[model samples]
Target: MSALYRQARPTTFDEMVGQEHVKEVLLSAIRTGRLAQAYLFSGPRGVGKTSSARLIAQAVNCTAQADKPCGVCAGCRLVREGNHPDVLEIDAASNNSVEDVRELRERILLAPLLGSRKVVILDEAHMMSKSAFNALLKTLEEPPEHVIFIFATTEPERMPPTILSRTQHFRFRRLSEGEIVQKLSRILQTMNREAEPAALQLVARMADGAMRDAESLLDRLLALEVPITLAQAEAALGLPPQEALWGLAEALEQGQIRQALADAQNLYAQGFAARTLAQGLLEAFRAGLYAKMGLGAGPRLESSEEKLVAAMTALDESLERLLKRSDALALELALLAAFQALHGSAASPQAAVPGKPSLPEFNPVRRQPPGAKHPLPEAPPQGTSTPTPTQGPGSRPQMAMDLTQAWRNVLGVLKINQRAFFREAAPHLEGQKLVLVFPEKASFHYQSALKNLEAIQTAVREVMGELEVSLVLQGEKKKVESRSATSLREGSRNGPTPLRGEASAPAAVAGLTSTGSVSASSPPEQSAQSAPPSSPIAEPRVAPLDEPPAIAAKTAESALSSPPLPGDEPPWPDDEIPEESTEAPSSRAQTLVDDPRFQKLLRTFGGRLRKLVQDTPKAPDAEGAAQGDEGSDE
Candidate 1:
């Protein structure tokens, strides 16, 4: 009388409809006298776990039947009445402390007063604390004779491994829709009540495989009306009409946006919660999707196979993305997105069912014929342009000089493996070109960059609008090889020279200027002995071009003695000839005369220089003095 679920709860294994597997196991154990000291019953809620535990207790202590529970016996009747002295039931949720477990341990050790054996049932056993579980562990492993412990929990994962190892685990399953409907029908017959078949089916489906929830729903319906119908059940439960949900599915399949929105608004107008509507739509679509994939269609799906597949696939995808938000706006948006995706021309097969290749991806939305243009206005031609004031050079629109920002943006969109390669590349902007340069040695990276050129461009466009770009390897474009003069000679002697190769004149001059002393072929001892004591090569010397002959000679000696300026480029374009010995000034002059670069320098200034052997710098000085004396006398 308290409620249909409590009043009609099964008292024996035979009366329980679902969980046949568990019933068979418990029956076999009782028949064989293989009863374990501790047993764990685990599964989803409202699936007869507590009822099964009670039945087991009654079966073991009943005075009548040896194999099963004698429901009419004094022991079974006392168990059913919840007044059995020998059998104990504990709600572990509220009393799960170590003290409670210890008290139970003290009581469990006592002999049965009114039954053959003492039995204990602990419901929600997973709620017990670690210490409490440890306290119960020893009793569970080796209990006194004629004492039994049965543990029931919806969550077995929370139980300790030691507890599980000491007991036998039996799993209870949720009742199916058919099983729930059968149980509800049996209850209705017992109460001599009449209800529509559709109402019972709706209650079962809404129960979500829980028999107690279905019974509770049925009790609510019974309180509303003695004889219930589908309409009254729907009204009492606040469920939207199945007809309306079916209509919404039809609207989606037909690509009727106005109808879909109007149907949803109407459902809300009829007092259905937004969340309930979303769940209903999800179920309907889920059933259709299953049917499309050759899975069995559920209780009610009115739509045809062809249209159902498309509509359900679209709605299913949209709901997954938006169902977490159970508000009206979220539900509306989900419906709209699904509709548009199913009805739009650009929607691809992959977009329809992402990550599923077996489901053919075809555009469900109707499209216009090719070359059919709309009446909208077209843009003006490129020649008809408008001019604006020019931006300053520094402020000009171009890719950034340091492409760290752009590269990061680009890498964000690329796949993981591609990002590693692109990270090593350096980006620079030169005029209209966005150049990505890699080291010459990493040819693979250069090739990969080229391979993913389109993806790179797409990312760049996303980040920096539109721009032209180029790929470059560091030393690819400029055909310059940096080889030392010695290396050049070695390569020439060891291998064939490449086509169009030129030994740079500047490089040769730089080499000669760097190696200012005697050539590498000269012996160190002989080279040291060849230098004269006053050769000016050892002592510092300077050459002053504007001074008199004697003074200029001394300055030149000082200038020549100092080491050649480090890395100074020679004015001429070839190597200088080396002297056999720096013993005499004439010998040095002769060496300079024989050098091709020095001869070229002289030829370049031939018209400006004059040489007279007899009339030297002294003669010019004497003439200038005579002229000055004449002027003074006058």
Candidate 2:
């Protein structure tokens, strides 16, 4: 019997799963006879680079009428058996040397022993030394008509530009978990192997979208005599099940601190690996979020993981938060930290999550008014704190004295509660109105900011007292070739905390670990104090950086619409995301979010982010008036 199982091996081009685009391009190239001298296949491991290379070798060597290997043909059979003279396979990893490449170059010059073309397939090509790549460049640069090279590597970035330039590069994408599950389930059905739904989904996820990974996992499932469920698989793989992770999150949310710690210890005691525990719980948190989104019968789930999956469907802002973190390393770290937190251990310096988490802070700030003139009076005299009913479109805003202070208050509230406006805030103060400026012309980027305008206005009114609040949003205008221009753009870090201001921000740059410093990289704060008295209808209300970002934005917006102060700094430039105050390179220090600044912003912004564009340009010289085409098409 063959060492490989029939179900585990992909038999045809059509049967091959995922990598659809890669397969399509190759098939077109082959059918059109547009094959090149060399090809480079690169992507993450388990993502089909090597498999695709082998398929290409077979496609070219096949002596049949179909686009697939005919199995019985001499070339096809030889290729399948790993003995095709024309289909030369090499492990470039161990054989990475100048001499090895030289020898291969000599072989490439010769004609095929059996098939019409000679295909030299090199796996892990990135492992080839620089000298080796240099040696092979000449031959690879100009190979004979009978020669073709298929190079595969998990890391394409490591490959030299000279070598890369000569090859037709095809990026093999990572397979999504859903696709992997479909492929795995199909393979099991064809093999007549029974699997619990939980078992199957677990296997697919474990594959991380690599077809080969799914195959290997399927093989393991079949190898077991008994039926597989999530529990059994978790035991076998030393990874926590979805329930374990969900339960941990629930525990954290319910304030069951001891329970969280106990569950974490139990997981480790149950033989789960640290890395696996960290990542698995993180993923389960995301999955449970999806489950929580829907109320009734949860979306179809693996019978075993159904309960776990149902908990994830949350159709709210939290879901938005989950969708936002697309980077691999960030996801990994988030999960890893959750594990550490569950373990009752202090967050590793490496984790960098500051001491003040978000959930607890959400409530206290929500209680404050949008535009209250006086301080939040903690216990305002019964109804006395009501906004002193304002007259419309008037320049005489009663709280004019507190405008800057009110803006500072509103900015802080907005930063924590709602981010949409906080995101593209180049707000200008126009009388009592707060006109928010957007970075782009599209409605999508401006959608959120537009939606909560009323809530924001109310928030502003609560803080600034009895003034008309008109939310004006100006998209990128085509004011071409202006004699000169002045503007303020906002910037933020990728972390949870939105920057507060110059006062709340960290040093310009600080080294990461031992490497080069991680700079704040945000647009510098503009000062409300600088706006001239000639500003529009009102007087200047407050100083800059003394208040939160929302308040700053309100004040800036008021100032802008109020009137140009000639050389004075504008009123409503969004403050940057707050930094964790640190003497060293740690993102773990207490952020301004833990300070009074954090509280004031949440109260001021009215608890809703009407708008936010993740990436926007920096207004570096807006204060300097040294404007060039900076951040656009955000």
Candidate 3:
């Protein structure tokens, strides 16, 4: 039995699948009797360029009364049988010597015996020697009236420009996956064999748009002589299961580095070609990307658009590094890198605040209010008692007026570098001195300020007009005992017991974790007398370092605090705002606010964006002024 492709070789223009554009032009030319003397067919191998060439030859010499290439006509049959005296098919790859062209030139003088016109088909014509092409150039440029030449090549660029300029070039394109599948279905029907639609689809993809190649593959499968299933197709083609590739893609998307690496190694062990596997992964990822963009349907993998883009990017990079040789380590490393690229975003330093992980753990750090100097207490220990201030007779009183306003002014005037040194100072007026109390945790910040004391004093004097400033680092060990006792009492009287290590310890004992300091030349006794008044606002309260049990575990439970799903109530019921507020505005709306293109538009016409009340109307005089401005610009 001959090969399947040989048996299926198209003899007529209508029998050729795909290349409709090429077929239409050739058929139209033949029907109009305006055929070009020389035709050039170029495209990827097995897309029917050569087959189409043969069909054209048959059509031009057909003896039928209707359409040119009636297969039953003697002229068509003679060409199909390769016994036509007037027509010649040359394999230019082997007969590319000058002697071959010289002989052909001598034979061209003879007239046709069986057909009205002579046709010569040169396959792989680009392989011909330069000398041979030169010899054929004159005959090709001005051939006899009865002669026609058809040159087909996979690489047209290799052909000489002088020769190319004389021929009518027709580009043949690869068939679409759908088109290939349809053709395969028809072929299977001819064989009296059954194939699942999925099996045929797989065969189409494996063909990679080469119609002849697809036929050759189907020929092998038909040899099995069994009802072909998708599994059988995969085995016959030596392709790894789609599930395995999808699983690898899932692992990469989920940031499962180890799993992705293992999958690569496993596929390599299963004997799949590295280049072929990489190519498959690339195609799958490309399809997923298209689906994510709403361009087309793809594999049903439930992943966000961000993840699909990331996976595609990873696969693209990995495919480039993929070597066709035995070592699979390069591909494995690429998989690891891809997973890291997707997963590393969560662990980025920018995602973290002082004492919290990134979302959906919205345990946002307690940010200070716009003008306040201290952080707010975090979920304050219930029922904690405040200590009373002690007054001293000898204590000199600073300006008795509120210092908060003055403190804020000083902070604004301070340079950015200097502000970092003093931002942690919790200040309050006491007698004649302004006491700046540093929490034990901020002892390092206090130390950092020692060198910049003069700068702080100058900034303060400028803002508050010569007030006495005293710096005090809260003593660590002594206060720990007192605060722990207060916390325990509060826990016993009310809410849940505070977790051990819930309170922050002094930096001195915590290994001096941070470096910031302050220095002031005031007697310790004066600082002692300058205790802050019993008010929560008297000092900035520091949040405890230890996290609650709910926060310690990394889980989606913490994300409940984030914006709820559609129709859900706001997670915090006590807050007056409704749980389900309107959805956040689209990104396009936000982008418009700062879009550079919008900036250009603003510059082109002098205009500023502003809000207008519904009830408000422009006054006649204001309208006149606006018109005048427009007139002036014109």
Candidate 4:
């Protein structure tokens, strides 16, 4: 095995391929004779923190050493062999207690046995307990001239601030992909090995910025014969091919549960580890996002052109972002559950609950709810089971639907347009009309859907049963008038006021009235003459900014002769109810709601309407007045 391939560990600082900045500082200290009593080295794994510490020990104790370390020297050889008496390498992870640190402090009091400096290398120093750190604080503040402490940790944040402040800290950075690739190539060339650059690149990528990892991976590859290919790289790394990943995605897109499950099963059968699958899925989602995020036209998915590349790109981006936010274990569990639900056996009486996916307690993970129901095309009402998709790429699913189902389909298309309002107002549907009683009429009248009757009806009638929807605007007419209000009011089967107005709410140019009880029996022309042209105009008062805009008050002061009760429709005078008129009591009521004084009138007359007829008095003139009017309202 040695001859076949041995890890060519760094024998000197120069041989340490990456982390040039770290090597320069350490070497400068050795050359300048300005070494610190304690040092901290922090970086990702396989970046040579421990190896550098070893090299520093040999450099400091060298009887006959070169710029970094002379492997030929006895001290250097001993240090490399891990048996140097003067140097101690401790795993802080294992001996992280106060007692352990106390023992080391006692050892530190003694002089160097075999070498000039007695160096203690504490690996994973971040794991040291608080008391252990406190126990060494005094010694660290004023250590022996010959004693040196090197603390190495992957996570610096975990270290105590006091301990960190005492030591000289050096940060280690990961080797970039290109750097790793170059180093791997040089290593392979130095060994007189033959390997494809692409294969080497693959190994470097798998290393993910760790030079040590890349080197070890290269050694693993070199164990086999030379001339490595992409297939060999994939197989050795246990990563799936890109095609398999795309297949998984395609199955998910189509909602082909069975095929998707079978594919997942095949992956497990073919030694497709769950973590590996998770990584592959992540990559696919990332690629999808990249392709979809482009606003301009792009290449379509070659495998499934039914979706424009743009559409797939969008889905990919969303899925990629979602996947990245979670853990690998979580992702794997989701994949397995999806596979099991699609391919695993359906409910046998003895099986676990049907429809719901069960993740193993051993993996003990939460699975995301299965994706939204995909709308598959319905067959032509007969023996056919497969219905083709309505070909258009979308982030959502589509159904092969006919015109008959279009209405319901359209409403489904809308789904819950406004959940808050629908949740509050849906239950109000009664008979053929749906009423929304708002606190202020302005909001109801200004509602967009109500203004655009055609669009609202089209959106609603598609999903809901055939019905007429009335958006009865109550309270006051909105200050801002538009098509939305018009749509709602136009469809109103019964308005609390007339839809058409003789004039705008505040336009009082025409009507004039006497202060005395204006006769309900007076004609419009005679009423117009009662007040002169010089009569002061009543300007429409606007509601406060904080309050919802108020509706235009109805012109009830001049129009209402009969009094109104709370929630009651005021009766028109006997001769006033026009024969064959289209006005509804509700329409008339709408006009009343529009009037600013209408509410006040209702309160005043309510007691009279609710009272029983206690006494009957006959006035001779009342006989003619009460002759034919159906209304008895006073």
Candidate 5:
């Protein structure tokens, strides 16, 4: 007439399936007569919390023996039949109001009707209202000597602290699968029914550690009135067969995605839901993992632990999706995505075949060894006008090499900014002198190269060994040379160059001459014999050409009176004029001031020529310089 779980409810502490710790403590307290005024039982569902509470009530009122609630005693029978006058069982879930608790408190004060003590059990005690708990708190803390109170709940944390602190707390635990299976077997034996071991195990797993749930599931299977089999159990529960799940897990382990998908689709077609299939496969993989660890019995799979774990992870990720949308196509798509995550998609071209040779992996960047040189571009062929160095007498004899290669090596060794300027120039080595010739229009490049001559010369010496370096315009070399000779002749006839700050008239003095020669205020001497050549002369600083004569004179006078700053060049002598200049103007500072491009820059910018400051070489390590250059280029 009643549910199977109620028919099989535990009647005594010894009859309970698990929670031996709770049973041992309660039994000792009952036998020693050290009973507390109130008791609290807390644990998960269907694991003997209510059963234990009832057992305690019957034990305290039992009259026959100290073994407590002997099944043959009148008090135990009345408690089991739910008609004991002194034992009261209240469902706190439905009667959790303050008025109900006030009535309970008034009833607890009355004497026992049929037994020596009155026991009150409040099941689901955590459902009681806060006010109800407060009303019951004083009585629970100090109750009548002839009465006892019991509170049972699944979540003790929800109960008020005052109520919890006034009771003797006992915690019940969920029974393991083995204990549940054994208990189910005993129950089936009592009913005179037979069940396969696999069927019992499946029922226990589905119960998820709750004895009542397991009993109910077993009772459903027994309604057929036939011996229970694995197939019948699975079909009744709407679960895929264990063999099908194992087959899918095997396919996944062996990287057979097609076969795995086929197996999943077959299960789905057989009326099994997606969530059911996913859960079954997950259990199968978990059993495999356990078997791999030698922990318990499971499907004896050949999959390694890592493969089983990976398969389990895939199943777990797909299980969430199956929960949201449980359909045939969704399950298939989930399986496919999981397969691709583990083993790449079937349509991927990169997958390896069994017999054919696999394609070699190609990396676009080739790593070079440390300190190895990057291969230079090939040298131009002969008669290609690539510059070649000429060995001359009284000069350092160098190895015969391609001048183009030598120039490239020098460019590579220079700093990034210097290389940007010098790369536009074509190199021509004449004897020991290396001339960098720029196009007539590339005056900026030519001027920049001249400013960075020291860095270029240092790099050249590293590559070609101490060659004199010169920069020249491609078509104006001859004109530059002739102009330098004429300037030297006029300078010999005149006196020495004036100081930069002097207020002398614009003149073709020995050193202060520019490209456009201004007329001299002093008449030139008729002496034909030239003065002997002196040491190399410094280049003159000329004023801007567009300025008025008065303003130019004033600027010169101000410059003459101002003190020279640190590192400033000393003024030239007033009487000693050089006669014959050895170095050509194109190779020295004079060439830069005399070039039309340089004059144009001066006129456009409207500024006098300041002192020329050459950069002194700092780093002697050529490799370090090359590395620094490459870093700047990047």
Candidate 6:
């Protein structure tokens, strides 16, 4: 007539399933008669806390000669039947008030009515009010020798510290799955019914370490009056079949989002609740994770450990929402989101099918074919005067305009000062080498450009793949004169000027001045006088100064028709120089300032190149010239 859990409640310590430590302590106290006045039992529900309390009451008052509370004794029968006057079981949840505690205190002072001692069990003791706890604190601290108190609660932390400190606290733990299964097996044997081991294990898992819940589930299944099977257990619990749950898990593991969703929808159509499906899937994933980790036995899963963890986490987070709304669509959406998280949207079944055209992958960079030239304006024919839009006073007509445009683009990405310094140089590409030619008089710009040569080379590489860069100063007769004067002054201060093989001034300066016929080996006086007022370095500048209007027209024709000068060569052997003219500093400065790129830079910075000053040739001092002649004779 009663529930199976109540009919099969544990009445003795030996009959209890777990909590060995709690039992050992309590049993020793009872046998040796060293019991404390108060005891606190705290743990999760259904782990024999209340039963242990009842057994203590029966044992302390038993009339047996040995194993006090012998199940056959009259005192034990009286307590078991709830008829003993010396023993009381209080439900603290309902009678938790100051008045209830005062009444209990008043009754505690009286002697036992039927046994040698009085036992009081307060269940769910944490539910008592603050005032009630205060009222009972005094009695619990120093109670009569004949009175024993036991408090059981699922949440002992809620109780006041003052109350917890006055009693012996024993924590009860949840029974493992094996222990619960063993207990269920004995219960089924007592009921004279048969059940599959899997059915019992399922019942134990559903109970979640609670023996009362497991017994209640087994009771429900037994009412069918047939041998219990896995299917019957699942049906009785309103859970989907294990096979279907495993199928859904497999689909998700294989990245078959559509198939998994369809399987879930089918389960929903068969009257399975959303919460039930989610719970079942959570268990399946947990089992698979455990099996992969070698923690326990479970179904073989091909999914990686990370994916299993992700799937489990997804189901767990969505379980609360699923319970609140009970919507099947929410579960499906959670599955889809989880699949996408593990393997992006492109991992859908349709994309994995063979012979199907997949979407093109995205590539951020566009590469050109080998030997293909950039789209640029065609070079004008020989003997033509027409100039391309990119050509200016210092620009060469035969050089491709792409290099100039690329240089402008590179400048756009550099700092303002770098752009300003390098803007004076003309860009020319010969073969695979890039040349930046600075004006003869713009020595400051050329030196500044050289210091930042690494930055310039990097920018060049970014625009035009892998190309060598060279910085060269436009050679001139004035440069040669300055060098001769400098050498004479240095020879007078230090010793005679070193020969070509000896160390000299900076290599870059020597490389520039020696481009003319006056080599480093030439004596200062002779090189200064016989430097041939017109040297090969002056050829390009002479053409521009002599015939300005026909320069662009003759640029291509002269390169093809003209022969090399006697001492003509690249200023730096590593660099290639395009045919260029050394226009006056003022003219060259005007050409750069008027350019659209320079104009844009000026507008951006709100400034201008106010004056273009050319360095005037200082006349050589008489002493230095005399010293140079003496040094040449020596």
Best by TM-score: 1
C-alpha lDDT score of every prediction, in listed order: 0.68, 0.57, 0.67, 0.60, 0.71, 0.71
Candidate 5 residue runs with Cα over 4 Å from true position:
293-301, 344-634
Residue 429 in candidate 6, Cα distance off native in Å: 45
The whole-model C-alpha lDDT of candidate 3 against the native structure comes to: 0.67
Indicate the worst ten consecutive residues by lDDT in candidate 2: 508-517
lDDT of 5 by residue, 53-156 (tens): 88887897787887667866888888888999889899999999999988998898899988888999999999999989988888887899998888999999
Q: Which of 1 and 3 is the better model by lDDT? A: 1
TM-score for predicted model 2 compared with the true structure: 0.48
Using Cα atoms with residue i matched to residue i, what is each candidate's TM-score against the true structure? 0.56, 0.48, 0.53, 0.46, 0.54, 0.54
Could you tell which candidate, 2 or 3, scores higher by TM-score?
Answer: 3
Our model 6 lands, by Cα RMSD against the true structure, at 20.7
Q: What is the C-alpha RMSD of each candidate to the true structure, in Å?
A: 16.5, 27.2, 31.2, 18.8, 22.5, 20.7
lDDT of 1: 0.68
- Candidate 3 residues 488-557, lDDT tens each? 6653332222122222112111111111111023344543333222222112111133322222121112
> What lDDT is reached at residue 428 by model 5?
72
N/CA/C clash count, model 3: 17
Superposed on all Cα atoms, model 3 deviates from the true structure by an RMSD in Å of: 31.2
Per-residue error (Å), model 2, residue 39: 0.8
- Candidate 1 clash pair list: 349-361, 540-558, 541-557, 541-558, 541-559, 542-555, 542-558, 542-559
lDDT, candidate 6, 248-281, per-residue tens = 8878888788899999999999998888888898
Off by over 4 Å in 6: 292-298, 345-634
Where is model 6 poorest over a 10-residue stretch in terms of lDDT? 607-616
Model 3 residue 566 lDDT? 38
